[model samples]
Target: MLLETTPDTSAFMIAGYTVAFVVMGLYVASLFIRNRNLDRDAEMLKTLFEAESSPSSKKEAGKSAKKPAPKKKSVSKKK
Candidate 1:
């Protein structure tokens, strides 16, 4: 009868787990940073859009309320 012994893989298992945890942590941190940047961009775009549209619309309304200029009459003299 021959007896067989299994090889110990605890170091490899620990290394694998550590690599997985570090990769997962880095991925999560990247996601958080991207989300924060997107939120900031959204807020900036909203403010810029509001500022541009509101003032332009008000100016258009003011222009529309005014009357157009009248045309001048031309006179011709024949001798």
Candidate 2:
């Protein structure tokens, strides 16, 4: 009589591969979403910073444009 070999279990290997692919897909998607959100935040912050700084700079420029009064010369001799 010839001896026959039984096939080994492969379901566990299939399940592990499936889980690994699913997790990697989810991680890539999450990274994409996070990068998009960060880009949006950066744009918003840049606009906000420019909006805040421009007015202050303009006001400072206007104030500095005014002629200042001349100071009188004072001589002090220290012995």
Q: Pick the candidate with the highest lDDT.
A: 1
lDDT of 1 by residue, 9-54 (tens): 9999999999999999999999977776676666556655555555
Give the lDDT of residue 67 in candidate 2: 22
User: Model 2: residues >4 Å from true position, as ranges?
Assistant: 1-4, 57-79
* lDDT (Cα, tens digit) per residue for candidate 2, span 1-79: 2576766669988999999999999999999777766766665566555555556757666444432322222221211
Which regions of candidate 1 are displaced past 4 Å?
1-6, 57-79
- How does residue 5 of candidate 2 score in lDDT? 72
RMSD of 1: 21.3
- Clash count per candidate: 0, 0
lDDT of 1 at 73: 22
